[model samples]
Target: MIKNIIFDFGDVFINLDKPATVNQLSKLDSSFCVSGKMNEINEAYEKGLIATDAFVSFYKSKFPAINEASLINAWNAIILDLPEYRLSFLEQLANEKKYRLFLLSNTNELHIEHVINTCGSDTFNRFKDCFEKFYLSYEIRYRKPDPEIYKYVLSENKLNPEETLFIDDVKENTDAASALRIKTWNLKPGIDDVTMLKDQTCFG
Candidate 1:
């Protein structure tokens, strides 16, 4: 029986366009592209190795044509929307107390700030309240697909791998969790929805 559930943020609970950032940035300046180094910078930033100001400064220095606001806007273009029905479903799960719930996502400060601004504090807080623990990459200094992060969560919470189920839109992430003996649902963005967890056959 699955007694614990770990969920990914983007494309799972909230709708997202993974390539939205690059597309949006290209509009601001054709030269503003995520080069190899920026990819590394992104990983570092998500892992909390780099501070928010420093991260933004790196972008400003790299792309002097665009102002900070525009850069931030393009960066946040990935976060699309969260459906109210999903929130209602999650709240029902939280209220039932049937399983310990958690949120884990590889995200940075800027994107999160945008999420707060877009969702409004009340809705965001209420959604957050549903989770027993809300873990973000920047705040936790750990991102998914990394063995350490999963181990940290499992060990810290004293959760059994067999009893825990992880849900992520990325197959790579779900594969990593599965390797650790944790059950997983490789959720499909458009075809699968988190709100259908109970109805889904994967849970069994």
Candidate 2:
């Protein structure tokens, strides 16, 4: 029986415009789209190895033609508007108390700051209140696809791996959780909805 539900924030709950980010950056630095520098920079930033200011400054230096504001905007272009339907679904899930709910995301400071700004402080707070624990990669010093992070969450919550349902849009993250024997949902962005699980008798 799945007694715990773990969710990934981006794409699972919020949408991301991956291509737009690459396209915008490519216009400034032709290398960004071809090379994996953007992904490398983001990985470094998400792990807290690089500070937000430092990352932005580094990006600005690399792409001199683009101004700081536009560069920053492009970096944050992955973030998309939160839907009210998702919010309502989360609220309902919390109220039911049918399962222990958790949120885990590989996010950095700038992305979070922009999410707070775009979603409104009140909405962010409300969303957070729905979770028993909200785990962030930067705060936790560990990111997904790393088994240690999943183990840490399970150990911290005292949850049995078999009793947990891990939901993420990324395949690698779910693969890590499955390796630990936790049930997982590798949701397709823009196509799958997390709330659909609530209707499935197999979920809870």
Candidate 1: lDDT over CA atoms?
A: 0.91
State the local distance difference test value for candidate 2.
Answer: 0.87
**Residue range 145-203, candidate 2, lDDT tens digits:** 89999999999999999999999989999999999999998888767788787665547
- Candidate 1 residue 97 Cα shift, in angstroms, is 1.0
- Considering every candidate listed, which one attains the maximal lDDT? 1
Off by over 4 Å in 2: 34-38, 200-204
**TM-score of every candidate relative to the true structure:** 0.97, 0.93
Find the 10 residues in a row with the least total lDDT in model 2.
Answer: 195-204
Relative to the true structure, candidate 1 has a C-alpha RMSD (angstroms) of 1.0
Candidate 1 has a TM-score of 0.97
